[model samples]
Every structure is written in C-alpha cells, then in structure tokens.
Target: MLKPNTLALTVVLALLTALGPLSTDMYLPALPAIAQDLTASAAQTQLTLSLFLFGFAAGQFFYGPISDRVGRKPVLLFGLALFTLASLGCTLAPNIESLIAARFLQALGASGPIVIGRAIVRDLYEGARAGKELSRMASIMGVVPAIAPVLGGLIAPWGGWRMNFVAALLFGAGLATVVALRLPESLARKSAQTLSFLSILRSFRSLLGHRGYRVYVMLSLLAYGGLFAFISGSSFVLQTVYGLGPMAFALSFSFVVVGYIGGTFLAQRLVGPHGLDGTIRIGVACLALGGSLMVVLVASGVASFLAVVGPMALYCMGVGLTMPQAMASALMPFPDRAGTASSLLGICQMSFAAILGIVLGQNLDGSALPLPLTIAATGLMALAVFGLTGRARRG
Candidate 1:
C-alpha cells in the first residue's frame, strides 16, 4: 500500500519481528537435552523461558519510553547490542540458574525491538493501513517459528544445543548492523514525549481505562495463550504422551501454523470491505465455536492428540484473523501514547500466556487432558470478555 517500496520496508520489519518468536521457538527442541545436561527438573528448566518473558515484559517499561523520548533508532541499536551479548552469555552458561538469568537479560533486551518496532510502525502508518502493513510484516515473521523447531532439532544434535544461542547472537548482531545503516529515525526528537515513571504509570492507567484497548489485549491474551499453552505442553504431550520424537513433534506443530496463515490471508481480504469491527466479531465467534467443540470433545471420551489439536487449530486461525483489527482498534486513539499502550498490550499477552503455560505444565497428566481443557477454558474466558466488551463499546 503506501508504495511498492513499503513492501520492502515490511520485509525488513518482518525480520526484526522474527527475533521474538525465533528465540522462543528455536530453543524448545533442545529443552529436554538442556535439562539432562544441567540436571534440572522440567519446571526449573521452564523457569528459563518464564523468566525470559518476565524480563521481556519488564524491559518494555523502560525501552518504550526511552525510544519515545530519544528516538527509535538509537534505542534499537543499544538494545540489539545488549541482546547480542546476552545471547552469547546464554550459549556459555554453566548451569540452569545462570542460563535462566541470561535468558532474562536476553528477553529484556529483545523487548526494545518488539516495543519500538510497533511504535516505529505507528510512526510510519496509522488507522486501517497500519493493520495491512502489520499483516504483511507478520506474514514474513509468522513463517519462522513454523520451521524453527525443525531447524533447531537438526542443529542442536549436530552442533550441540548451544548453537541455537550462538546463531541467535549472530542474527541479532546482523540485525543491529542493518538498523544502524538503513533505519531512519521515524519519531523525531520533537515528537518524543518525556516519560517519568509516574507519567508511564498514568499512560498505562489510561490505556487500561480505555474500553477498546482493554478488550483487544484480552483478546490477544486468550487467543495467543491458547497457542503458547500448546507450545509449552506440546513437547510433553506429544513426546511423553504420544511418544512422538522431537523431529516428528516439531513437524506436527509446524502443521498447525498453516491455519494461522490461512486466517490472516482471509482477514486481510475482508478488512477493507467489512472493516475492523465486523472482522473481529466474526473471528471471536469462530474461536468460541472451536473452543466449545474442544470442550465437548474432552468432556466425552474423544480426547486424543489429534482431537485436541484439530479444533484448537481453528481457534488459532481466528487469532490470525482477528488480531490485526483488534490491535488496530486498540491503538487507534492512543497515537501519542502508542509506546505505553503497546507495552500494556504485550504485558497482558505474555502474562496470560505464562499463566496458561503454567496451568498446562502443573497439571501434566502425561495425557492430552490438561492441554485441551486449558485451551477450551481460555477460549471460553476470551469469549465472555469479547461479548461483554463488544456490548460495552456499542453502548
């Protein structure tokens, strides 16, 4: 849309976006191996990821405002440098505790790009156009995690699991160099807002107080959490319950992402005509339907790996379909406060994801029960929130 060159810019942003999902998914295949190497329990090992997300969420508090104050480019370079170093540290960690610490720092640093990139986009595009551009960026990024586990499975065994960290470091540094050269400052110094801790708190309060933003964040948490629950529990469920090998499990998981892509393709075509509101209602309805089916399947005797995942895939498709409209509508009124607004959205998303993952992990039955129930429950909660919020906004 802006121009054909906009597509090129989206391509770069897509790679920048890849950093977040890449770090999360790439290491998953090696989780069991790392536990064996470090002599840690599954939950303790999971603590690494949890801490990374916590740090990622925490870092957003600082990074968003800093970029808003100074500019997008410098803050990004500084964050990328820190992220690169942290990734290297993760590779050389001597134990699980240290590994967890490095991951926290890594996530802390990664938060800069995630927060700033969105702000940068808000800097460049707005209104409905933002959603289309975001979808374009997401399409490039969305494909990475689909194959990352398979790639990690091959690389970890051949090069030892640490290679994942090393490769990530290299990728980060390369991204940093590209940013240093090509990325112009989108948010001018004059455009930058002075943010105190209290000011940031107020910004967050305002975002939460906004009905549309709150609903969108809730939508993300519930929908994205479903995927992450599957992510966190999949290895255990597939490998432990169904006895699928890591390579096999990774490929199977990759198959689910197709539904996500399909949904996005459909959503993009629908937005210009039906608009955000129509698209989101349709998406939530589909998600609720899929989630209800999953609940019934689990309640009856049909809960197996396929039974659980097949319907959950439909909900994921709804996520891809709805997220653009939901997010765009949320950020629409907060042009000046986009950074703080975006951070709250990220925090809500990750916190919900963390809770869902923990629930699935703690309730591990060496069966698919925990996974499907978790999925259905999250979907149901999201549906309730979506319905209530939709009515509230209309009123």
Candidate 2:
C-alpha cells in the first residue's frame, strides 16, 4: 500500500484535486464545436462554464461540513459517482441547455474532491510543510490543465465534442475506483455529533471572523478572478478571433500552463526561504506586473498571439505561486475545521470567478481588450488587498 505522508499519497491527493480541471479544462477545446452543434449563443455556451463554477461553489458548503462529520473517503467516493453519472449526462446531452444543466451537476460532484483534498492536506501537515505539500500537489495537478485541452482537441475531430465528456466520464469512474480501493480516509478526527445548520453557520461565521483568513481568502479570490477571465475568455479569443484551430489553441493554452507549473515548482522551494506571506507577496507582484503588461500590449493594438499568451503565462505563474501559499496559510489556524475553512475559501473564490467570467463573457467584443483588462484589474486589486492587509502570520 502507498502509505500516508509519502509521495505516493501526494500523487493520489493531487489526482483527487485534479477532478475540477479535468472536467472543465478538458472540455474547453470543444467549446466552439459544442456551441455550433447545439446552436447556442456565446453567452449561453459560456453559461455552461459559469454555472459549473457556481455549482462548484455552492456544493462545497454541503461537502465541507459533512466531510467533517463523516470522513473524507466516503464523501469523496459519493461525489465521484455523481461526477461520473453527470459526465455521462453531458456526453448524451442533446442541446446546450441540457449540457449546461449537466455541467452544473458535474460541478457539484467535483466540489467534494477538491475541498476534501485540501482538508486532507491540512489533516497531515501544517505551516510551511503544508504550503510545500500544496505546492507539490498543485504542480502535479498542473499537468491536467496542460494535457486536458490538448487531449480534448485531439478527441474533438474524431468523435466530436461529446467525446470530450466521454473522456470525463471515464476519468471520473476510474478515479472513483482508485479511491474506493487505495485512498485511505485522511480526516483523523471527525466530529462526533451530526452537523446542524446552526453549527455549520457558526463554523462559517467563525472563519469569516478571522482577519487572517479573510485576507488570504480575498487574495485567493482575486487571483482566481484573473485566472478565470483567461479561462472563460481565452478559447474564443484564441480560436475565433485569432483564427486558430483546436490543436493550435490547445498548444497555446499549454504554453501558459507551463508557466503555472514553473511557478508551483518555484513555490515549493520558495516557501521555506520566503515564508508563506512573503511568497504570496512575491507572487502578487508578478500578477500585477504581467497583467498590466497584457493590458498595455492589447490596448496598444498589439493583438498578436504572443501579446496575449506571453503576458498570460507570467500571470499564471503568479497564480501558481499565490494560491497554494494563501490556501495553506488560511487553513493553518483551522486544523480542526479545515474542511469548512477550505469550503468557505473555495466558495468565495469560485463564486467571484464565476461572476467575473460571466461579466467578461458578456463584454467580449471581437477584440481581445476585455480579457487583459479584466486580468489587470483583478491582479492589481489582489496586490492592493495583500498590501493593505499587511503581512499575515508568516507560516
């Protein structure tokens, strides 16, 4: 057996964490195809993504507390089952509306693994060690984004867009099987009493009351805002505006993913030397710098592919560095309530990203101006928040 606290365990946890991107990123290459085949408007097509993020955000409130009362493994398994079934629903969806509904369902299931995985990390590690572990896991999970879009792009031509969902179905089912056999329950101390609505509220309220938690959560939320703007808008911008095909678009996406992977790698090393808050400050600087450059480049009528993707890669690197440290720092003080804390952090992050993405989608002109503008605005705001909040307890 791959014992807990081993690299094997981290890999498994990373896979569990990967359920989110595998579902969303894998389908991105097929988006234009899905829109055409389903005869949906751009906004309607984008709803599939936005609604999934909303469902992902909303579902975490349930999973986090329940996993605290119950254990991680069972909740995760149940979620995987639902995710598998929902993937099938997406594969068989006849219209855009149906696909949108299925995506929401899929997201609800996907939420369980992500929140539980973060809680699991908190269960086993703390402080800088926890940040390192999260960075390692993120580095591993980064592969999914790099690969999923390319794989989906390859699959799109052969079996069309439905095939992308087929891959998601297989992945969910396979992951569920792995969890059932190999993954051990990570929650060391489960709440003895069942969770009441009032108790859940109290848990959330307590997390919200903490100044450090609020700062870290806002940091994460704003970082994600910039990232999701790229995610929600990039496919259309690259494929439609730039006139790239599926494979080419996927390649460009992977290039940006490379930067994120690099950031995660750097974060693992930097956390020990820089401390969590220090590392976060470094990352936020990158976020602001890269995002501003993108805005400048795009606004100056330099809409070359490099102009967009180049700056994006740098912004993504900042995301990679910022997210793990923020998450670990936020959860460090709440070891017992890691599940709930993780859920609240996720709820704020995803909900804000979903809203920002929808707004960006609605404003998408034929130019790439909106994407960089959104990125720069959010990135600068994240920097401002981190600066104003001052240094959090260095992990």
Best by TM-score: 2
Report the C-alpha lDDT of model 2 over 230-338, residue by residue, as the tens digit.
9889999988888888899999999999999999999998999889988998899989998999989888887578888999999999999999999998999998888
lDDT at residue 57 of model 1 (Cα atoms): 80
Best by lDDT: 2
lDDT of prediction 1: 0.77
List ranges where model 1 is wrong by over 4 Å. Answer: 1-5, 188-193, 298-304
| Candidate 2 error regions (>4 Å) | 391-395
For each candidate, C-alpha RMSD in Å?
2.3, 1.2
| Per-residue error (Å), model 1, residue 331 | 1.1
Which residue pairs in candidate 2 collide? none
Candidate 1 has which clashing residue pairs, if any? none
